[model samples]
Target: MSFQHTDSIALSELEGRAPTHSDLESRGITSSKEKDFKEDVKETVADSPVDSDVLIRDGVQRKLGQRHIQMYIAGTIGTGLFLGSGGALHTAGPLGALLAYVIVGTVTYSMICSLGEMTSFAPISGTFPHYAARWVDPALGFAVGWNFWYQSVTSIPTEITAATILLTFWDENINNQKIYTAVICVAVISINIFGVRIFCSTAEFIFSIIKILLIIALLIAGLIIDLGGGPSGERIGFRYWRNPGPFNRAGLVESNIATDQFLAFVQIFVQAAFSFGGMEAIAIAASETESPRRNVAKAIGRVFWRILIFYVFGILMIGMLVAYDDPALLTDTGNAAQSPFVIAMDRAGVKVFPHIINAAVFTSAFSAGNTTLYSSSRILYGLALRGQAPRFLTYCTKKGLPLFAVLISSSFAFLSFMRVSKGSEGVFEWLVNIVTIGSLISWLTINVTFLFFRRGMIAQGIDMRKNVYHNRYQPWLALWGVLWLSMFILVNGYAVFFQWNTTDFLVAYINIPIFAALYFGYKIIMRTKIWKPHEMDLITGIPSIEETELPREPPHTIGGKIAAVLF
Candidate 1:
């Protein structure tokens, strides 16, 4: 096998002395491949006699346990599922919307599984960006890291905006949305700055409990209403499905009814992307979780089942109880008014239900914004550590919080102030539109990176049996995931093609060109190669990571056993 070498002085050398080219040459230090420099730096740092505190402080401690991991998985049940699904139900019929979510869930599970396989072996803060560099190219890593960071950072303001909107459901007289937005942003930032255990894990655990309980309550209520147990004793079991019909006739040209329904189904498929956006956050928490290799692997295996029960089943129940043509679902009011679950209860004459559901929805949005800040900040810190971002971003507090990165990520939350401008709502919407596609892009990259990573392992003569975690199906699942995600990305904006609107087109497809610019631009600027399998760094950080002892098993008490199984 041919080899490529770089004169790059890894970060370890930066700590030793001024990183001069001549100084590096004097030591005869050379990296075998440009793509593998990160591994070389990690190995050098791990073996160096320099203070371990330097490296330790830059990275977070693994204070999160199984309960925390479970909370992180459920933390993002926000506007995407609560309010966004209303659009799906409106555009597509009940069955079409349900099918859309089910399909996305399948693809999301594949993406999560791929991420889990890579992270279990090397639980680092850099996550997929590091994997992209290791398995693909350094330039690709730079692009993916920044793209994901922006996606995560921008989402905080989106959630904050959604939360403020939800709050107004109680009293429309409240005119100052900025006050609520600013306060929520500040609160989320403070929680993150306090350290992961105190905030990310604890807040998520509490919020997830709130979300899960509310969802369970909502589902039980829906079932009872469907069974003729409401105040009017009216059974609504699939009645709406038969009346407004199971399929929606949605198209610009007014074509065949069946064809239009199919088109609506496709549109819903794309819309479902946002609902499952942050579901892979479990993999992102790899570095912060206690016994990450074991706990993350466990979470990865179990989170999908939980998602199916909470999200998919909830959607199914909504379909059974709520008609697609319900007048309340057509509102642009922007609150619990748009939630099908709330609308169904209101239609069934379930007084006082909307208030309870609205409160739960508000909590979901807040928790989602909190997780977004945490994820985005860590991505920035990881990028800085890998030399893809500014050096100052890697600065962490004594408590292991990436304070600088947190500040930068939260800065975007102020964008919510655009709501005050009379005519700037369109501008704000445009900015918001640019970010929604990022999650799909991230999913595509994860699958591609996983493919290369698997090949690298085989090429380097590593034994698959020794892996800490591996997906059930060998490359096929990842291949299908990549193909499906790519298809979804390309055709996500199909509605624009039927009748083009410049803004709608831009909103649907703009992220593609932006991602292309970043990827090819970085590749051209750096002159990096698509990494060769033999050149991959399969074993660099593993030795040091394996040297540390794994956490002891959980206690054998009944509560511990239940936690062990559920988490």
Candidate 2:
């Protein structure tokens, strides 16, 4: 039967023909339900009337397409793979680092699957925060939304900081560095203010072209170097792997997997995770697309292959070309003069290519910062919609963009300048730490929300297996993501607290207490309780102004058939 949003589905329509609790119980759908207990909750939401006369201003025009989606994914993948892989390689050894990326990518793929199912069913601008409010709890939506906002704010400076450092590759003058960073930030903010389509389309074109070209060049150069085409006619051919021995020199020790290797692995994992972080942006964009269900499903399905090919293979090639033990690889001594990619090109005797690569690195950092701004602002808009934050943030411009939310979110970029004044990298490092924790929280929440969502579906006699976008191996995939995130939080969270010679422990550990305070604090203030399926908001099921006018029959035209197929 086709699904349609109508005023109501009569109880008589369900009547004796409805799937009873015993039927679900016999199918072993027990959780919070039991045999002879009250009947299972229905899938229908309460028919509460909204003030239809009141209009919530529609934000920014929705103009993005499949190309925009593809480019956003490419840009996110490029950021970490191109610049961050060097650090990961140094930590885990070539083999260990490769393994870590593959493992993380696999976990990410699973989480995306869960997210895809939900997004397809209910594509909206609010995305996951809205889902959390509807299917989980309002407090969860608040916490997740604000946490992501903070992350985006902090990342602005982090990316600018990266841009400043990268600038030193060609010019060591600090004055020039400051000017360039300011210009790039202003440009990014302008693009965002203009509209998401403009920002997304520009980013998609530049990033897609650059990333594809870079990958092709790296693959060709790596092959040539491996085949004895270097200055000394030496074939690199996996010698670094053997000499350093699969694991790093410091990591191979018998005691606790060696401090150097373990630290290296942890560091690389953090970077890899950061690089892969923006994949979730696709879910956010899914809301604005013309055919969200099909586009979102296609995007999520491509993630596994994208991570493996773009991240895994890209790092493998980089490691083979440059030995992990090279002292230059460790030059992150707070100096931008020492990018591993630039260093590798120099070592390979390609004098001019290093400059070319440096330029690309600068653009990549700016693009990351730009996208972060867009994401964080959209989340703020989501929060405002749920009455978690101030209502003014819900204001949208004629273009349909949430102008106030974007401005408020962009203000966080000013905080990045504080890093310049302090002359201490501590602020920047603290920001990164907080971003990591926030990401972990988001990951955990998504999985937990999915668990409840799936259970609710079964309880209401909705067979998810029959849905177009299905999540098999239910609680297992969600459970794995949660477990991994928990382990990361425990290990990394405490590491921030107990660092041997650092005063930033409190700053780093502050996110946990802050997150806790927000969650419980909002729960009390809002008087929100956990939700059951039947009580969920059902925002997606609510008919839009346009949809409300259409007849409730399956279309028969060729165009209609195509639209149905696509959606």
**What is candidate 2's local distance difference test score?**
0.67
TM-score of each: 0.90, 0.83
Q: Residue by residue across 403-451, what tens digits does model 1's lDDT show? A: 8998999888788777655788888888877878888999999999999
Best by lDDT: 1
Model 2, residue pairs in steric clash:
59-400, 59-401, 60-399, 60-400, 60-401, 61-399, 91-264
Question: lDDT (0-100) at residue 134 of candidate 2?
Answer: 68
- lDDT by residue (96-133, candidate 2, tens digit) is 78877877786677678778887766666677877777
Worst 10 residues of 2 by lDDT: 45-54
Q: How big is the positional error of residue 522 in model 2, measured in Å on the Cα after superposition?
A: 0.9
Per-residue error for 466 in candidate 1, Å, reads: 2.9
